[model samples]
Target: MNEPGDIEVERELVRAMNDSAGNEPVPAYDPQQLAASGRRHRRQVWALAASVAAVAALGAGLAALLSGGGPSHTVPVTAGPAAPRPVGSPPASAPDAARGWATMRTVLLAAERYENPATRGTVQLGQVAALFTDQAAFTRVWGSGGLGATCGAVADGALTMDHSGVLLYRGSVQLPDHAAFTFDDRTGRISGVSCGSGQLPGGLGHQTIAAVFGSQVSGGKAGDGLVGPQVSSLDCSPADRPLTNWYGDIATGGGLAVPPTWQWQVTLNGDQADGPLSAVVDHTGLMTQATCPTSSP
Candidate 1:
């Protein structure tokens, strides 16, 4: 009885053991390789950490934008040019000259009214005197020597304007006489009077004097010689008449001297005459002995 199957199993088991014993031993692990693997693991971990940090930074930027804490960007604006100013108009010298002529007309009208026979008196003369710059001259010419009564009465009058801007008032005041008045363009005051012809006999009246000279007279005893018969001695010469003349010595009631500039000539019947018949008043309304240019005919 040979058990050949059991012998085969025993032979197989012996072969398995012999094969296991014949296999080579396993080698030891390498430290360098393990270190290299650990390093690779650490690199993977660092890569993951860097990715997480990038995501966190992106979140912080988004939060800053949402909170309106970002820097501002501005755009530039442009402007336009300015506008110009307007010009003005010219002066009204022509109208002013016309007004000046009107003023002269008013003065003539006042003088004519004062010379009315019914209105003859010191009270009436005073009203006329107010128009003159020299009150004393007014009194001397009208109130003295009974001149107002002597001058007779004015009947009618006519006013004529000259190209030279002189106002000639021709009237029949108990005689055929013409009184011319020159007005100062700047002051509008009567600057001079060229009176004479028929009205000189009674001497210049208050209205006559005031109509030519403005209402101002030099006050003081020095000017007192201008009154009375002494005024008759004034060098009112017609030809080559010196502009300046001295009348009445200062010792004799104080002398009155005419400056060279206050030149005024009274042409009577084509001949210049002396006396208080004609006068030129300075801008100050004071009577000056200065000779004025002979008035144009």
Candidate 2:
């Protein structure tokens, strides 16, 4: 009986050793622990590979969206391979007179109103500074007083005048504000423009007014209905002083309410008044020599 049991034990030991050599040792618990470990490692590697592939696909989709599938944003202009078309040029009548004038007017108004009426107080002054030669003239106009006086102008051919008006005041009291537009055949632009009464040195004297305020005005409208009395002839006194500096104790009543409206005498080098005389203007309107008589107060 002892010999039989001992033989059985030897057989059992041989089986265990053979099983370990063929299929690896059984782990702490499961019978198929070794096989399960190999399978789990393979599964983990495959899972990582799949995740990398998914990320690559996502990156490619984003790239396609951003590039629009091409290198440029502008639409490509091309003709079919069978029949190529020719590019045509613009018409000669595309000057767009109305649009051009409207744009110019807008720019002028912006500069006059908000684009730094003077160099000292505003930032936009630099933009409009090129419009005037004398910088000191601009500063003087804004610094002299508050919003006591104002001027405006407008012109249209087939349309009526707009954005052109005035409000005049002298020391707290208001004056008769006058604003008008007329055609100037000579310059092909609107001519007469009246803003308001200003302590501007020359008043509305011929030379001072024409030289100072001419550029802002335009020729006339399409119809001849707006024509006024012919200018006849113009004359200007050499030593004439603007009425603003005069009238200390004139025979008139009230304590100098508004500046006198003098006839604007036109004096130009040669006969440039018939055409365009290069001038200097500020936000306060035309810039004139501010001497004793014409001192632009």
Per-residue accuracy of model 1 over 20-121 as CA lDDT, tens digit each: 988968789999999999999999999999999999987887888899876655778676664442211111256644544444444444444345444333
Misplaced by over 4 Å in model 1 are 1-96, 120-130, 133-155, 161-175, 196-297
lDDT of 2 by residue, 1-297 (tens): 469989999999999999889897555766598789989999999999999999997788689878777343567888666643222211113243233233223223332234223322432445433322245533432222211112322211011122233222222232344332222222222223334543322222222233222221222122122112342112221335211100010011112334332221222211122322222222233332221223211
Q: TM-score of every model?
A: 0.25, 0.18
Number of the top candidate by lDDT? 1
- Candidate 2 residue 20 Cα shift, in angstroms, is 15
Model number with the top TM-score: 1
Error of 1 at 105 (Å): 1.9
Clashes of each: 17, 17
lDDT of 1: 0.39
